[model samples]
Target chain A: MPSDGITAVKQLFTRLVYSLGRETATRELKWMKQALIASHSPTLAAMLQRRLSGEPLQYILGTTPFGPLDLLTRPPTLIPRPETEDWTLRLADMLTPTPVRPLTVLDLCTGTGCIPLLLCHLWPPGSTRAYGVDISQHAIRLAADNAARCNIPSFQPAPYSQNVFIPVLGDLRDPDVFKRLLPPFDIITANPPYIPKREYDKLPVSVKNYEDPAALLGDPPDSEEQDGLTFYRLISKILRQKGMLRDGSIVALEVGRAQADAVEGILQQSAGLRNTQVWKDPWNVKRVVLARA
Target chain B: MSSPEDIARARQLKELEPLHEAWSNWTHARQSLEETLPLMQDPDPTMRTLASEEFTSLTHTLSTHISTTFPSLLVPPSSTRDLHALLELKAGVGGSEAALFLLDLLRVYVRYAGSVGWRTSIIQSSETESGGMRDAILEIKGEGAYDALRWESGVHRVQRVPATESSGRTHTSTVAVIVLPLSEDAESMSGNDELFKMEDVKVEVMRARGAGGQHVNKTESAVRLTHTPTGITVSMQDERSQHQNKRRAFQVLRARLMDVKLSQDIANRRATRRNLVRTADRSEKIRTYNYAQDRVTDHRIGLSLMNLTSFLEGDGVQDFLDALRRNWQEEVMEDVVGESE
Candidate 1:
């Protein structure tokens, strides 16, 4: 029996697992062993080596379940985080008690269309139409594929109806493109790039190297003191435009660590927007900002 | 006398009662305006301002009644108003140019459906060799899909330089659009099994054509059905299974039958009415898309607007639909008023 080879591989994986912290190491180790057993390929051993070198677990698995959806996870597009999943479910719960009307939702920086897809799944079909916009073409394509794959019920009656999820390729950085968007949306949600420039370097090698730079960083930090708030500013400005934000509509945004206050300030400064509030994540950090128009 | 015609006439008058009430409200507001005009010259400045404001408010109310409430009263209740629509687009003439325009027209509707939250799916399509669509059938499913898209049926002419053309000279191409309301009883009709006599139908199975590769060609998955009485043949090869193809072929056949029945009813109604509404004529060129001028001209209502690109992308088509509905209501009102007289 080649006991040395199995023990050596387990030891290497244990070191890699330890890097993720003791709390997650056991689970990650078990998952890696299960994956290895399932594939039983030498190539998977190479993948394990890559994972040991700090490749994101999502990329290694190729998929992650967000709410009721199994979303395809690929490199370059930001992986669906647990923080996002928590807030999205909370948002859905908030809207579930409301009267059913033809509601329109717009999601900015819709990485994997996770927000819109999950919302559409949670909301009653035919009453909600959700649009997801991302700057990256790859994200847009992947999001569209996910939308098609999910097969969410659309308001369209039988014979010709399709999924209500629409993925648009657009850069929120451009005010002109933002202005061109059709308005009167009932809800707007965003999980934009909010990681500060200084924080990017401090991020684990897995996130810094494997994840998309566009997904993690906002407009180049103007100064050392400036935090990532480029998307929040642009979104707020666009929302302030005449006929952009509908009366009594809600805008929910996922914020970075300790950035909720700044995001709330941005929303409060925007015309017609009020009742800014910050929501804490499961870990008790203020991770989301909610505002009403 | 209480004859059937008299009963119908009385019922119609009762239906018009709401319009009469709106007219009376307008008249009352106008009377108030007349009364306020004299009060505007009152000795007190506050009274004058009050009278002027009253006059402005009354005038606004009167206009709103005429534009919205009055027109809404004129629209005859339609049974097929809530039904989904089957919109078919086919290249009429100008060869590949027409095909290209047909494709663009299809995109316009699809994008428009997306914006409005309506769902659209291509039922069948025959593609031209040049990557243009020769014919396409779309099923637009949503609440009031038929009502919104009913006026879209007609010949749509486009004036643009063809991609195949060497010169920049503008060429005209025509695409015919036919809109039919999907039967509300589609499920029951399909399930009845006895709706169409078996002896009068011919069914054939063949290899599926187009993009499916070796597996598609190897198996006889395509199904074609021909109605012996009407000589209408429908072939569906999109599905991998012959059963699915057969089912789809039957669906198309049923829709066609329903369309024929509805058109006959429309024709009979048209024959009875002396004043013909030219807008309903499918042969008429209802709209013109001029790329050179960046304009879309709807010939029926004389609506010509710039921003052809946006219009083609399904952004401004709602305005056109609204205008068409308004025109239709006005025409129906005229017919009702004439009949009452």
Candidate 2:
């Protein structure tokens, strides 16, 4: 029997609620129904049923809130975890009190425009301007869509509603990106892909099977076999360029929990780097490093 | 039916039971050798290497157990103190590697303290300001902390190509540790108060400067107090308020006084020809972490654990510390029994 859209959604929603429990299930079902209503498509019912069978709601709903902005959750762009959001908020707070005029911020490996869009919305105009750079075109498109979805006033064309929010499409490993967007930034932050490639394949279905493989597993091994710290080393190199950062500029990053000492060693070896301090996550894991360049 | 030797052996074994596990690793290799007796004549170099390695390990363990268990063993202090003791360096002479081995010793102690629910704060640290720490004074506070950390007073040497080295050649450095017991009360440990007097103390207030927030700056709150008579100094920069610093300084002064009095009491007892307990030597290389091989070996009781990375990351360290402590207690008891006999 071909069930009606309302009846079908209610049934699927109840099943989802049973599987994921009341809170998550209810939220996901609401998002599904809203998406269905907005599109006015019957296929949304089948998709909601697919989600009830344990498909991640981030993929099903097609978007997730990161900081103050909603980001498109799609292929080649990793879904922003709650820990990442917490770190983003923390970095935002750290960069807020700068006395310098027009605070410039850079978000490296910025997937789906999450960090930049959130900063653009949350930051006061004229005080701060943020740029997000990512290698994946798919990711950049998702990021662009996210910025549009968040209605980033700065990126809007003519009567520029806000001061500055630019999403530059560039590879972090490439020197060209730094040459082009080589503005003096007060803060450089990234939740760079840090999980070892060997460990990525063993991740649970929630991450491995669903998330973009490229976003999760980055560049291949170098001579030293240091894979995860690739993005960090590259960023450090680019930031060392003239006029890119002021003396004692903060470079904060979210890294793998156990890599604190190793990363500290890296910063120590960095030419212009001065210090590396570890900050614990709410779980007491050594999660963030605030390295200065 | 039990003979005198049987009874003595039984007592010795009982005394060693708590500690024997730390030194009994030879049994595993001996058992493996027995199993591989069929392959004793094997011509393969790989098999020969494996067998020889196991055999050498077993022999090393056997020799250590024999020396420690000997009835007339000297049983010197494992740490350095104000007291005098005979010194001997029988083995271990790898230059820079030996020094690096010493650095590993300090790291183990630090990690062990962390495992025991104690708060170890770096009160004062003079860093190489390049890659490694030069000398760091850690103030550990917890129940029984003084007694536990008392064993850690020693000279540590480290040998490694510092992470900042471009040439990737090893360098050697040495650090000395002095672990003073922050005794609960001076009168309890010394039974007297001749060594420390308030009149002998010289108090000084100075500005604290380090890596904290506005507390490190905008204040003249840091306190540095020195005992003029004893030449002993204690700094109280942990706290922000002047009153707190004074209180902390006084507490440290009291602890140092207690330590002095206790040492003096021990000296007096020895002069009267009384038995003094053996203390661990601080100069001894207690533990070594060979990063290249990913192995950590405690040289005292000859115990080696292969999982170096996980151990340093602060997991399952309590198990090792507990085993070592129990062994040390048993070793102490064995010496007492030998004396009584």
Candidate 3:
């Protein structure tokens, strides 16, 4: 209730309002205040200065909660979106409650290794083998760090079972990237770059400034045009080249708006993936495309 | 065979016949009792003894009729018998002490739900810096959960010295509880168009996304929905999953809207009858938990029980609940008798 306290809160509110709307700014201020109070160290000015400089709150706070796992997020590697968390949980729940066999998952474009880490944590009463591949070494490192920090207890339901999460630096575009992975995986998931280049240029500063452009843009490195369906094409191409997925295994992809049908077609035509289903986010956006090989 | 309408009419007649029979029998018994009363005034010792014995038996039969038969025939079966309850507890009046007591009251309901084999989940909660509860929402699921905890919706006062207090003086802080039926009426409301329309609701997430998919990095997952006309806004940021939060918010909002409509309907229907049923009113102080006396008292039924520890632990609260339910039924029976007279 002090004058300076009022001004400080108002200043923090003003800084957040430009990037996150007025409503969100107020809410975030509340969150920050609570977080500070909870930590028992009320350094409002330091947090305010960091926010005033346009740094994302996740990085400022040093952690973001992804379901049960507290994932560590940093710059350039995409912070895990709530939409992604929503779809991943739904897909994990689709598998039968108890599985006799150990599960193997490969998450492509795995920034901060959130997808594979969560899958590993939530895997059925058996050991898990997960591979998180990203083009950025920083991302791969962060992903590895998250896997270590998550503290998922390894389980053995079979003779040769051990929980192993490997973060590999590899590009999804290259066919050789499949060689780096022990495939015939029970599950393969990707949240590849799906925003077209033209739209990426026009994105909000909060997104365009902090996150890596490669993670946002879906066009090929050498291509001028962009339709945001570049990764969907690459995913299908790699699956065809390697044929490395187990027969009738699951493959799930997070797609852009109105891209489910096209991605469904691309996956179905070549990858021999069937039983295609489009999953919607809370906002009723067709957010995830699921199929079985 | 009778047609469906004919069958319904037959059932109605079957139900009405019992009431008519009960009415006539009740009148006949009263007349016989009255005749016996006049005989008791006569000087004959045998006649007086027989009349007194008849009066005792008649009184016993009429007591059962008042307590059991009339109430069952009068009040309809409760609509909320099967509903899971959503209990909201918020601190009121006093500052930090009230919030702490609110948390204590939350635990009481939660323990009560658990002891009765009901599952309870905290959908949302907030705490003060000193570990006091600001507000909380608990979803209690089980058969007859609402029936058991229906009368719990009101302001509950706790007279206890604050844990942080050095003065050792009893503080009369209050915690308000509002219990709503968590019914699937909300889920079916989307298509029914009876309760509300999806079009009237505007949703705003904390971090808004311009376009879909891997384009943006969004961590702020708080979602707020405002029913524009009524201005009933439900914002959920907890549960760590936007999907779950959204579902919970909608369920809470829809249940609240349904409750408002249901209360109005009940009020209008009961306009002609003398007030028998007590509506859920949070402004009314329904109960008191006095720590000094080690007692819990439900003000509505004037029933009090010692051992506040076990009461808050859910053991002693059952007696108060049963009494409240019985008192309500008796009120209904009295109303029916009054109407017939």
Model 1 lDDT tens row, B140-167: 8886888889999999999999998998
- The lowest-lDDT stretch of 10 consecutive residues in candidate 3 chain A is A153-162
User: DockQ for all models, in order?
Assistant: 0.01, 0.01, 0.25
lDDT of 1 by residue, A79-102 (tens): 887567768978987885222466
Residue-wise C-alpha lDDT for candidate 2, range A106-149, written one tens digit per residue? 88888776666666666665565678888778777787777677
- Share of true Cα-Cα contacts across chains kept by each model: 0.00, 0.00, 0.43
Per-residue accuracy of model 2 over B1-341 as CA lDDT, tens digit each: 99999998996786566455544555665676676665655799788777777767667666765655442233443332222111111113443344344345446656776676766655443222132443444556665666555544554334456565689876554445566666344213122255565667766655322211101112223467688877988766543234445566666666666667667766675566454455557676665555566666666667777877766665545555556665765665565675678
- TM-scores, all candidates, are 0.47, 0.42, 0.59
Where is the poorest 10-residue window by lDDT in model 2 chain B? B82-91
Candidate 2: stretches off by over 4 Å: A1-23, A42-44, A52-54, A97-100, A153-161, A218-227, B1-341
lDDT of each residue in A227-252, candidate 3, tens digit only: 88888888888777655776778888
- lDDT values, one for every candidate: 0.75, 0.60, 0.77
Q: Ranking by lDDT, best first? A: 3, 1, 2
lDDT, residue A262, model 2: 67
State which docking tier applies to candidate 1.
incorrect
